[model samples]
Target: METGFPWGSAPSVDLSLWRADAIVLFDWLMSTDLNAVPITHPAQKQALADLLARLEEVGITESTEEEIAAPRKMWQGHGLGGAPIDQSSVTRAQGSMTQDIT
Candidate 1:
């Protein structure tokens, strides 16, 4: 469906983006932020939820600390609320750039 806000001036949305990624359409979803105005259609809501669940299950966007930290010989003894991430891995993931979606 073509979409625009009531105030006008915003560009129309091409919802073909839903098919862009079998994994996750981070490109069109504002880098996977999903901060847009709600799509009120029930089917749209359900589809979105299903897609999110699939992504989380496969660990693409949702992964345990071990999956992330242990892969690179960066595991240190527990500290700072975590196993003290190595400076190398620390650089890969900054605090402000990460989010806990699960």
Candidate 2:
């Protein structure tokens, strides 16, 4: 088995050696270390763009300009205030009786 660079080894020029090397590239991308290695190949960039276009066709793409906005229903009076409570008050009055005790 051949060993690659150290923990922070620089990027290799060979793309054929990349399946394993790409992992290191991903680590760099996550750490905001843009200078370590360049993974900006033309083919990779095109592939990513194609994937994003397909996702947009299914409405999964995130874009601020063409966002789907819907009117939010106001729930201010969706509870008892929106319902009729007069019948309940009448029923309570009819169920009660005045009792006298000496």
Candidate 3:
């Protein structure tokens, strides 16, 4: 399976996100204090800034209340509340699985 990116051939890749998610992400990123974060390289900071600028250019900076609320409702409905997963069951299930070694 060729899962990894072909970095040698591809110079840049496009990113696609739901409009509501993109708006929320942009708002969060805008409110974050980059100075407090321990970013060593200047390019990293510039890259983040560039992302924000692109978002702004695409009208992600301004969103309607419905747009913002829709994603929150969708997430809540899907049970993605940022809760930590219960790993005990996962470990047990993994242990029970038979490995087919060729």
Candidate 4:
């Protein structure tokens, strides 16, 4: 649970406790708070690198560096100018969407 400090709280889960082998960890970061934590120190960097390697060894091509760096697809023509979107949504938008009645 010692994630160097100040982190380990966002998304409110202990990143160090859970199995680095779990794909959910990566997905959680990507979908929850992508910028919540920065892996700058050598320890954090190595931990992440190990996770990626483990993911690769288990045949998970989804977390590849190239794929992660590749441009994300957009919700075309949303007037958002090609903003990025989360990779998954297990629930409703949690906000209202009004109809444009003409």
Candidate 5:
């Protein structure tokens, strides 16, 4: 089985995210201490840095705490399907995931 791509090979993929979601993601990534995450290779670190650069290039930068918090609060109880989500449960899950990574 082919386990991975050859060296220097990069496949392109397109990602589409809502602006609010992208803002939240960019904030999280920017605030994260990647050295604490178990990255296996230097390329992974470079890729993350590259992603941050791309986000900034498109004007996503350090937002005020209020700006970062607003989107999370706004979407807390709603899902893409407009179904109600359990805010507390989601919060707990996010907390645990953050703990696991950090």
Candidate 6:
């Protein structure tokens, strides 16, 4: 649906979906940080919950503290809340300079 906000303005949305659709949605989400937001659809929330559960099952949810710390330092140094930025907030300004989606 066309977002009614002004041209180039943030979109407002609401939606729902099933498990398979939720998987794809969450996969997109894992690429972002949860703190940032114009707000993802509610389906995105359910999808993320599901994805986290799957990660727990696969053992990827458990990370070595040291391993996690290295990236944390790098992200802070780069001036991101941590690299991946915030999931809900699209770092559009960052993108204008970096040309990287993440």
* Order of models, best lDDT first: 5, 3, 1, 6, 4, 2
**Model 2, 12-101: lDDT tens per residue?**
331222111223233333445334344667566544444333334433333232121210122223345675436564345334432111
Better of 3 and 5 by TM-score: 3
**Estimated TM-score for each candidate:** 0.28, 0.23, 0.54, 0.28, 0.53, 0.37
Rank order (by TM-score, best first): 3, 5, 6, 4, 1, 2
* Superior candidate under lDDT, 1 versus 4: 1
How many residue pairs clash per model?
0, 0, 0, 0, 0, 7
Better of 4 and 5 by lDDT: 5
Candidate 4 global TM-score: 0.28
lDDT of 5 by residue, 7-38 (tens): 75565555555456667878978889978767
lDDT of 3 by residue, 73-100 (tens): 5455333566554566435433443212
Query: Across residues 1-102, which tens digit of lDDT does each residue of candidate 4 receive?
Result: 222344544222323221222444454433543234575676776556555544445544555654333222222433366445544431133123221111
The best candidate by TM-score is 3
Candidate achieving higher TM-score, 2 or 4: 4
* TM-score winner between candidates 1 and 6: 6
Give the runs in model 4 whose Cα sits over 4 Å from its true position.
1-40, 62-71, 74-102
Minimal lDDT window, size 10, model 1: 14-23
What is candidate 2's CA lDDT for residue 36?
39
lDDT of 3: 0.61
What lDDT would each prediction earn against the true structure?
0.43, 0.34, 0.61, 0.39, 0.65, 0.43
Report the candidate with higher lDDT, 3 versus 6.
3
Candidate 1, 3-95: lDDT as tens digits: 233566545332221111322333233245444648777668656655565445444454444544443343345455866556665556433
Better of 1 and 3 by lDDT: 3
lDDT of 5: 0.65
